[model samples]
Target: MGTPKQFLFLELFMQLLRIAFGKNMVCYWDMKSSIGYRYSKFTSNHLIQGSANCSHLVYASAHFDAITFEIHFPQHDPPLPIFKPKTLKQSHPKLKVYLSLGGDDDANDKYDQLKYLHLMEGSEHAQQKFIIRTIKFLKLHQFDGLDLAFPLPRNQPSQQSNIGAFLNDVNRMWGSPTTT
Candidate 1:
């Protein structure tokens, strides 16, 4: 699930996939641009507005199964509250939606702000707070699950350990099945 800020290419890709596979595929929008470090204030409205005119094209397309809008988190700040989609899935009740955490880049600074000295070994308190807040936000917006995208820095022992701790914390908080 790559980031599709404009959703134009994603729309076309879905169309092609439908033609080629003859199956309904899911389209998860891994929104890298919304991460706090690069896009702290970004919101779903940005994506919606950017691709406003393409809503009809996306909704009318027959290739997509579910369209999960991933919002990468790069801050210790509580996850952004979900904003209901105005177009896609308005008529479909079974479409799966999700709110993703982390991204391709490591959120070391953000983790530091949260007072988690080790990225991977966040305290139980920190993990619980993150998971609880995230779940609240997801439920508010009607999301179905979460996607943890914490990427470890390669060849860095300390960073890798931190990332491992982070994953462990996440697994403990959200459980294995909740991860995407």
Candidate 2:
């Protein structure tokens, strides 16, 4: 949701974009997951300064049915903007904008090895909090779905039940919006 304060300004700004670029306007995902972008640095660009923080956010948004903004667990506290209703309203209403999880492999690389894994392997309290916060963040951000991009921890005997419970709770609460 967007504040009423953003309505007039957002509409006007979007309209200016439409006029400037016409129907052929170059679309893009301006907001980004900082950690995901950093980790994806390629060998070709290793010596060069990367153009900007967010890539893979195609500018031509209208051509796609969806756009996903992958969020490292730490990216969204409540949620981030540019994904809010006012911005999405410019796109096809049916467009699916998802907030994906688990870009922390590199994020946690410097510190705790299983930072993302903690959400899966930690105490029930931490795990549940992660799940609940994720749900709340998505709703607040007007995200259409959740993407789980991490592999489950290896060789944990209890993971079968734990994962099942996690899936059940997320599915029960989130329905089709939750994707593996």
- What TM-score against the true fold does each predicted structure earn? 0.48, 0.45
lDDT of 1 by residue, 1-180 (tens): 336653567567657766776544554453433454643444455445434223221111001001122223333345443345434356444455555554443334543233323424645665555555656555665566665544444565654456566666655766645532
Candidate 2 accuracy as lDDT: 0.44
lDDT of 2 by residue, 46-128 (tens): 11112121211231111100112223333355443333532543434434555545433334343343454555555666655
lDDT, model 2, position 100 = 49
Model 1 off-target regions past 4 Å? 1-13, 19-24, 30-82, 85-87, 104-117, 162-180
| Colliding residue pairs in candidate 2 | 27-59, 28-59
For all predictions, the C-alpha RMSD in Å is 10.7, 13.8
